[model samples]
Target: MDKALNKTQDRDLIKGFMKGNDRCFEVLLSKYKTKVFTTIYLIVKDRSIAEDLFQEVMIKVVRMIRSGKYNEEGKFLPWVVRIARNLAIDHFRKVQRNPIQHESEDYDIFNTIPRSEGSAEDKIISEENTRYIKELIQQLPDKQREVLIMRSYADLSFKEIASLTDVSINTALGRMRYALLNLKKLAQEKSVPQSYENKVQR
Candidate 1:
């Protein structure tokens, strides 16, 4: 069965990775790095923070694997995700205490999308819709919002999300499901049209 084969392959990859098979490790990185980074990005909503956290996650993963601390009994992706989530949480906590916001405001991912000149009505509609959705996302419970942004914007898989957020896959799924439900609720309350929903779902 595909499930059994996947398990076997994971085990082999872990073993190979532990043995300093750099290529095998690269394979693992290639498979999960973008998903992990995107998940982190969604949480922090800052490109620099996301990039730093992503690198930290990989470094921690490499260390754990090299130190033989990585257990193979469970899925690999989830474990790495947990690491990423923990790191992000720690980073945020540190920021809250020190309150030293990153200096590069212009580089924040959640701010300002590049756009070209368009008809006045089109621009107004687009900007209003964007503002509404952004507000809606900000209102979601932290967990649901985190999952939705990561999956919807950053394109992380549920498995990767679970790993990064330190939740079970089912929990990740639940958060995403509730996030969408709440998003729908917000859109309806704002009288967002079906056309907007269609675009968002894409």
Candidate 2:
């Protein structure tokens, strides 16, 4: 995607919306709904919960723009995804109290923090070919999983990941590197299909 063009379009849409052109808001939402919805679904993992959270995200986006709280110029998608991520995190804090629910008896990949739960039954990331891969992703260490998801699934840049994760840019890059390496090792150990393994960056 042409970043300059996207930014200009977003700016125009935002300005139009601010000037009471409601269709501009609709167009903006249409442009980004897939990304915003995917970000929420990847985090929440449950279709029903994801949908509910997605509505909350859209509502928040509208409110923020209307209230003049959205000041991130030329970064419309990342700004919106940040709101989605925060709302998903809030949901996790409320409902994800099962940090050790699925720990392997031999080894636990997750640290002490609460972990997000997902299953093969999910509507979005639960394809027959991708279910195991998603499960492996859930098994990744928390920080690495976060970087991988934000980079690969959320399509965030290293700088955005760093800012959102409260780390340095190099630290964000390092986490993504380690996340890929770990996924490779985990794929090999699990004998995951090469097709699915190839989906994650090598």
Candidate 3:
């Protein structure tokens, strides 16, 4: 039980994995997989898509470790998050439509974060609000939407996002600024205040 609650010593395990200790890789996954899943799910908001992206992220990490290309100097979580974020961005680009928009036959994540017990009218109103925000997000331009996701959901800093997206920090900031402006406009049109208002970078 302690192993479940305690933070995994990733450095030693990773170094061991580099030395061909395959069990260390398994240990690393057991320690971090839940956190990785949560992070990806929060961004993608679709269980199947998040699971697919999670596998892709893990495969890339494992391959990098095996290939001796893994850099140990950086924090593992951020590095993994960056990898996941980039893959998510690429997935978005190639698909050109939100995965949730399609009626999927697979499992649903919305059921997991269940609505609070409430009157039917309250539930209806909550769902409508959520759908409205999702529509607002969809209305954003590609770069703005990507930046907003990377910053808000992935929790990446401007510098990290710039590095990942091959843009200057100011450009990333600018994209974020424009994203807020667009989001606020959409919110106003929908007669709602933006939830991410304060988090938006100037």
Q: Alpha-carbon error at 43 in model 2, in Å? A: 1.8
Q: Score every model by TM-score.
A: 0.66, 0.73, 0.65
> Number of the top candidate by TM-score?
2
Candidate 1 wrong stretches, greater than 4 Å: 1-8, 102-105, 108-139, 147-175, 188-195, 199-202
TM-score of candidate 2 versus the correct structure, residues matched by position: 0.73
Cα lDDT of model 3 by residue, 27-112, tens digit: 87877787677668656656788889999999999999889777888767668888887787798777786433653756545565
Q: Give a tens-digit lDDT track for model 2, residues 20-94.
A: 878778887777887777667667665567779989998998988988887855488888888888898888887
RMSD of each: 7.0, 8.9, 5.5
Per-prediction backbone clash count: 3, 0, 0
Write model 1 residue lDDT over 80-171, tens digit each, in one string: 76787789889989998888665385564535455548988777677767667766787788989988866775556888778767899999
lDDT-sorted candidate list, best first: 1, 3, 2
Model 3 ranges with Cα > 4 A deviation: 1-5, 16-47, 85-101, 104-108, 114-132, 191-202
